[model samples]
Target: MAKAAVLVASFLFVALTMFCEEATADYEGCCVSYSKYQLPFIRIKGYSIQTPNDYCDIPAVVFHTIKGRHICANPKDTWVEIRIQQLMNKVKKMA
Candidate 1:
């Protein structure tokens, strides 16, 4: 009976952990990225054009979606790294 209880508890723990992991955001915050050439082309469905450019680092955000499928790229050409850092800071403060 004790072994069965332990097994059930372990199973419940594992299931709850997995559920929470799935509920969490894929990219909750922003980070400085030097190159975005390798990232898959994600369509910005709901997000507006905050900053537009054709280069490595870009500034963009997910207006609504939380999963990887909704996050989009901004493609800022000049001063991308700096701008992204600033945006990340602002987001941190707001959060």
Candidate 2:
């Protein structure tokens, strides 16, 4: 009986680990942007969100363009998350 219980517990542990891993979708250094009332806001990774007028460093990600140009705007503030790899590449290119 003790051996059976141990086997069941091990099986459950392995199943749970696999399930969790499968549920996660991996994106590197990406941020989700949204609009409100024709205003734009962004959230940057590793830093607090700020107004569009305030300058902050963030990794590059493709976003929707207006009139074929990119314009950062503020509606209520933005949320951005940048990954370490993307940020590192930007620095390397700058150097």
Candidate 3:
């Protein structure tokens, strides 16, 4: 009887842990630092702005390259600002 109870408890614990992990699977990826070098406009496919939040504390711009790589950049950088503007303009035109 005791052995059966222990077995059930172990199963429940493992199941609950797996369920919790799946729940947070959609968690956003964050950048710890920014890239120093600038990439050309033609190479960038898209970008996302990162701001201080409960999970992410650093402010950055994550630039998505055509080659399926993410490049973290300082939002204050001149080239990054220009790239952001370009992306915004493209979206506006699409609407």
Runs off by more than 4 Å, candidate 3: 1-28, 92-95
Candidate 2 wrongly placed segments (more than 4 Å)? 22-95
Q: Lowest-scoring 10 consecutive residues by lDDT in candidate 2?
A: 22-31
Q: Which candidate number maximizes TM-score?
A: 3
Local distance difference test, candidate 1? 0.42
Backbone atom clashes (below 3 Å) for every candidate: 0, 10, 0
lDDT of 3 by residue, 27-58 (tens): 36677777757878888899877787887777
Candidate 1 lDDT over 1-95, as tens digits, reads 99999999999999997764421113333322323332322321233333424442345542323243433344454433444455567668989
> What TM-score, computed on C-alpha atoms, does each candidate reach?
0.27, 0.27, 0.61
Q: Report the lDDT of model 1 for residue 55.
A: 41
Specify the highest-lDDT model's number.
Answer: 3
Give the per-residue Cα lDDT of candidate 1 at 51. 40
Extract clashing residue pairs from model 2.
Answer: 29-83, 40-73, 40-74, 41-78, 42-78, 42-79, 43-78, 43-79, 43-80, 44-80
Q: Score each candidate by Cα lDDT.
A: 0.42, 0.37, 0.77
The Cα RMSD of model 2 versus the native structure comes to 14.4
